[model samples]
Target: SLGQFAISENGGIALAQISNHYLGNFGMIILALIVIIACLKTTVGLMSAFSETFVELFPKKEYRFYLLIVSILPCIFANIGLTKIIELSVPVLMFLYPLALILILLALLSPLFKHSRLVYQITTAFTLLAAIIDGLNALPASLHTITFISVIINFAKDFLPFFSLGMGWILPSVLGFIIGCLCQITITVYKNKKSSTLS
Candidate 1:
C-alpha cells in the first residue's frame, strides 16, 4: 500500500502505469538495478549500518527487556504505517523502494560494515554490484541449512495462516530472521575482537 496520492484527481492511472512499468519483468527490473547501482544506493547497506551502529553501543544481551520495550513498538508502528500506506495505494509503495532497498544494502554489506569510510565504500560498492548480479541471475535453489530451515518454517507457517496476511508469512519472517542473524553475528564478532584485545 503505497501512501502516495496523485497531485491531481485524474493522476491515478498515470501513477498506476508508472508502477506497472517499474514492476513489469526481469529485464526492466535488471535495468532499474543497474540505474540504482549507477547512483550508489541500496537498502541492505542502510539496514546493516543501522543494525551495526545499534549493536555496537548497545550490545548488552541482558537488556532484552529495555531494548525490546524500546524497539518493538517502533517496528510494529512502522509496520502499521506500511500497512496504511499499502492501503492508500499499493502501487506507489514500489517507488518507496528506497527504504527497503536501503535495508537490503545493509544486509548485503554487513560482511564489510565497520568504523571505516574505506570499508563502508568498499562494501557499498561490492554490495551494489552483487545486488545487481543477484537481480540478473536466477539464484539456484540449494539444499543447505537456510533452505532446510525455510522449508520447515514454511511448513509451520502453513498451519498458522492466521498470522499471515494472505500468502504465507514465511517470506517476511525469513527476511527478518536473516537480518537478525546478521546483526547477531556482527555483535558476536565484535565481542570476540574485544576479548582478543583484552587477552
Candidate 2:
C-alpha cells in the first residue's frame, strides 16, 4: 500500500518499464494498448465537452457545424505540430487552470456564502488578478524577453505568500471573502434600520 501510494507522477512509465523487464516484448504490447485506450477515452471526453459547450453557447448553430469546428481546430493545430501547439498553449492553460479551479471551488462552497453575488464577484475578481500573473509567469523565459512579466512576478513573489507554490490566489481569495462578508453585514444592518424606521 505504501509503495503504491508513494509512486511519483512518472509512476505509469516506471510501471511500463518494469513490465517490460518481466514480460519482455509482450509488456510493450500491454503498455501500448493501455496508452491507446486512455488516449481514446480522453479524446472522446474532450470532444463531447467542447462540442456541447459550443452548441449551447451559440444555440442557433447546428451541432454538426460546432463539432466540425471543434474537430478541425485540433486537426489544424496537430498539423501545425503538437510541440508547437503545446508551446503556445502552456501559458494559456496555466492562466485558465487557476481560474477554473477557483470557480469550481467557489461554486461548490457557494452554499456556505448563502449564494451572495457580492461574495462571488469579489472573490473571483481578486482571483483573476493572481491568475493573470500566474499565467504570464508560466510562459517560457524566451517569450518573456520583455522585463514586465518578470517584474510582476518578482513583486508578487515578494508580497504574495505561497506565490512560489502556485497558490498565490489563496490570500487574495480570503481577503475578498472577508471584505464581501463585511459588505453583506453592512447591507443587512442598513436594511434592518430602514425597515424598523418605516414601521
Candidate 3:
C-alpha cells in the first residue's frame, strides 16, 4: 500500500487539485499530510528491504554491518541525484523486466510441460540472449555508439519481431520452448527404443 501510494502520488495530487478547487485550503492540507506520510513510509520500507537482502546475501556479516552499508549507499546515490538515478535505473529495469516476465510465465506454465528441464533451459537461454541485447541497446549513448553494438542493434531491430516493443524475447523464447519439447520427445523415444532392444 505504501509502495502504491508512492507510485501514484502524482495522480493522487491531480485528485487533490480537483478537491481543492471545491473544498479550498482544507483539502490541500490533508493532501499534503497524506503525501508526506506515504513518502516516508515507502522510503523506510524500501530501505528495510534493501538491507535485509544484503544481510541475507552475506550470512557471515552481522546484520548491523549490512544495514550500515545499505543506509550509507543510498546517500551516495542521492548525492548523485534522483534524476540521474532514474536515468540509470530505467535502462536496467527495461532490460530486466522482460527476463523476469519470461521466468514468471514459465513458472506459471511449468505444469503444462511436466516441469521439463530441457524446456526451461532452452527458453531461459533464448530469453537471456534477447535480454542482453535489449540491455545493450538501452546503454548510455556513448557505449551504444560503438560500431559493433550499433550494427547488432540495427540487425536486431531489422530482423527480430517486437524488438521495438521491448519484447524481442517472446518469439525466440517460444521457438526455443517448441524446439526443446521436440528434442525431449525424440530423446525419450530413443531411450525407450534402446531399452526395448536391450531387453
Q: Pick the candidate with the highest TM-score.
A: 2
List model 1 lDDT by residue over 54-165, tens digit each.
6777786434444455456556655655435444444233323323564565567556543334334433443343333222221223422366545554553455343223
Expressed as tens digits, the lDDT of each residue in 1-199 for candidate 2 is: 2343454335555666677777888988988898889898898888889889988998998778877887788777768654566667877887787778878887898898788888888888888898898787778878566788878989899999988887787898788778887887788889999999999
* Ranking 1 against 3 by TM-score, winner: 3
A best-first ranking of the candidates according to their lDDT comes to 2, 3, 1
User: Which lDDT values do the candidates have, in the order given?
Assistant: 0.47, 0.80, 0.80
Question: Each model's TM-score, in the order given?
Answer: 0.21, 0.79, 0.76
Q: Give candidate 3's whole-model lDDT.
A: 0.80
TM-score of 2: 0.79
Q: Give the lDDT of residue 82 in candidate 2.
A: 48
Model 1: CA > 4 A from native: 1-14, 19-41, 62-199
What's the lDDT for residue 17 in model 3? 62
Off by over 4 Å in 2: 1-24, 59-61, 79-86
